[model samples]
Target: METQIAFAFDSAQVANRFLNALKSSGIDNLKAKLFRGSEKVIVSYCYEDKGFDQTAATLDDLASRYDGCEISIR
Candidate 1:
């Protein structure tokens, strides 16, 4: 299954850093490209049966790295 991930930051500064991280590192083997919204970064991830677990771990790491960033997965 494919999971939808949403990342919203408190400021553009934080958002930029998050974007840079996403660009610099590969988020596992996600097949989708990340696109930025006016205030958030959104991407779709498909990882068979481990979608939610990997998504959660990824979000947790990102949230810990960037204090002002908010993340949601579906």
Candidate 2:
């Protein structure tokens, strides 16, 4: 049961900040892979979850922690 969360941030700094927060939260089986576009930073992570509810909760938690940071989950 691997879950993936992809985040779009305004800049690399925001991406790094999000990464740090995710790491600090002690989330298990979490992976953040980065992609660079012309004007945006993409971060994708894979986690183990049985349902999207748990994953959404985690995503929301990070979104709240980051405040202005933009995030997406799938």
TM-score of each: 0.61, 0.60
lDDT of 2 by residue, 1-74 (tens): 45554566666677677777777777665666564542233434454454544654776667556553444542
Candidate 1 overall lDDT versus native: 0.61
Candidate 1: where is the Cα deviation over 4 Å?
A: 31-37, 50-52, 69-74
lDDT of each: 0.61, 0.57
Residues 1-74 of candidate 1: C-alpha lDDT, one tens digit per residue = 67666767766677677767766656765533334654566656675673346664675577558763446543
After superposition on all CA atoms, what RMSD does each candidate show versus the true structure? 3.6, 3.8
Off by over 4 Å in 2: 38-53, 67-74
